[model samples]
Target: MKRLMFYCQHILGIGHLIRSTEIVRGLTNDFQVCFINGGEIVKGFEIPDKIELVNLPAIKTDTEFRELQVPTGFQTIDEVLEYRRDQLLTAFNRIQPDVLMIELFPFGRRRFSAELLPLLDRAKAHGTKIVCSLRDIVVTKQDQVRHEEKVCKLINRYFDLLLIHGDPAFIPLEASFSRTQDLNCNVHYTGYVVQQGVGIREQKIGNGKQAASTHLPTPLILTSVGGGRFGHDLLKCVAEASKVLETKIPHHIQLFTGPFAPDEVFEQLQTIAQHRHNLTVDRYTPNLLAYMQQADLSISMAGYNTTMNVLTTGVRSMLLPFTGNDDQEQTIRSQRLEQLGVVTLIRPSDLHPEAFADRIIECLQTSPTSMQFDLGGVKKTANLIRAIVHKQPVIV
Candidate 1:
């Protein structure tokens, strides 16, 4: 079996890590995978036993994206950087992977170049085919032209394939990266990479008819703030909204305050949640998809993975995109999904409990329907990699 070394760095949210895990899970049956995680470990996330896991000293950024912190302990930033760089370089030399797969490099996470530059140099010397895995839309930099130039330079110098994990018909990559014309490597779209659970839901949702309800079980509402770093406001709003909704909807609210939430914020939410017997607050869960599958409605931020879950499960959802650091990626995604009638968008100004409650009422009243997306991402990605490994021509 060929060896695959995959590197992923997640700073603010676990979307990158979660998406990469699903992809790696699909790959373990075919490859000897070495997974390098460059961010804080999300404790409950499950990775396959066949994949070798390397956890680096955890690093994360604030919501503003201006400050980087070593959340795991007292190590200095430079100290951890040197440690991770050495470890990463050593892993590449030791693994000598048949394929080098990197998540969000030149397109984003440019902050880790201290090590990535050196690792890329080593991989090139060994003639390992390097692939870049990117999400659909990218955060736009203020000096975008200069940023695009830098990205083009890196791709031209190091990468063999640019695998965009999205469908062009839904939202083309060029929608965000205006300089796509300049990159020199081969680019392919493997469709939207959704959770594995969602692919199977299509059949179940197809054959099962909605049960008529004279006495419906209390509707289960699932709410999550992806990564829990910046979603204190959203959680607070939902808490307040729950009080307003109690008399009318009488639903059960399961609030997940992502693992990274500050203690003070989580405590505050816990205290407020005491007001409602129908509400429960937790740090994280290994089985979010299970909750989503059973939920009547989902209230959350518009992170890629969670949004895909919402789409896959056909749950009525209300989305508030994180716009901190002038990041418009989530907002753009939310808008497209809203236009496609996939989700309802929540404006920042309307995030108050009262206004949020109003939106929840709307979502609850709407009928649940799943849209068909190109969910062929994992299967297609595996095929493309195999073709590349065997020097077979690939067409997306």
Candidate 2:
């Protein structure tokens, strides 16, 4: 069996780790897979026993992009780089994988470029097939251009293939990368890799269900605001919407304030939801897809993973994307999906609780459009990696 090393980082939310887990799950049956994750957050994932996980000593970043201080007395970037380099080299030496699958950072993750570049050099010298996996959409035009240039330069020098997890019809490469023709020879669109299996199919009777069983109301609504880094507005909107619709609608609302939400913000949300028996506040659910699967109407921000999850679960959702950061990729993607009639898009500026609640009521009354897209390509992604390792041509 070919050995594969999968590398990814989880900063804000667990989306990267979640998607990487799905990819690893697809590959583990046929390949000797080892995961190299940077942060301590990897422990939260429900990975298979066969997979090897190595958690490197990496600092987590706050919403403002400041790196959290490590216990080590050293404070300089070089010190961090040296530590990471040693960890990466040691792991690579131990595993000696045939293929290295890097998630993001071909064009970005500049901080780790010091270590990653040397590792790439070593991998190429050893003839390991290097695959750079990218999500459907990149964030901004300038960043995307810079990323494209970096990919072209490094891919030509060292990398073997570019695997994009989106259909070309929905989002063509040329739109994001100006020099798409130059990299066309090595590019492959592997379609969307959604989370799968028995976990998604079965609904566990946890706190969510137990609470619902106790005091039930009409048309259950589930809303999530991703990592809560930029969710203060979303929470305020939900609260306003609940108050406005308290007398108008007879439904109960389930709001998930993400794991990263501050304690003070969560307390405020609790206070707002206290009196209304129809409103429920939950913090950090692992199985968010399960709730989305059962919800009559869903409200959420249009983060990449959240949008894909909503699409995969076929939830009738109203998306409110976070603005003010360089994170408008969600809005761009959500708008496209809305054009395809998959979900509804609501801008943060246009959010009114009364209007949002009315829209929710309308969506709940209507039938959800059939999800006609085939998501089996997630497995195909693993197959492509296997073929690359064996020096066989990929069918797609």
Judging by TM-score against the true structure, name the best candidate: 1
Task: Encode model 2's per-residue lDDT on 1-396: one tens digit a residue.
Answer: 879898886666666777788888889878899998875463234777889988777555666555654525567767876787788778888889898888876644666787788888878888888888878776554466667777778767877888878777777655556676776436778888887633333221322345324223447688888766667777778877887777887777888788777888888888888766678786666667767766778888887678777878787888887654466567777788788778888876657777777877788777666656646557778778877877787764
**Ten residues in a row with the worst lDDT in model 2?**
199-208
Error of 2 at 326 (Å): 3.0
Instruction: Give the range of the ten consecutive residues with the poorest summed lDDT in model 1.
Output: 199-208
Residue pairs with colliding backbones in model 1 are: none
Error of 1 at 366 (Å): 1.2
lDDT of each: 0.84, 0.73
Which TM-score value belongs to model 2? Answer: 0.89
Model 2 residue 48 lDDT score: 75
lDDT of 2 at 145: 60
Candidate 2, residue 71: the lDDT equals 28
Clashing pairs in 2: none
Residues 94-206, candidate 1, lDDT per residue (tens digit)?
99998999999989988788878999999999989899999999989999999999999999999999999998888999988998878898889999898875311221111
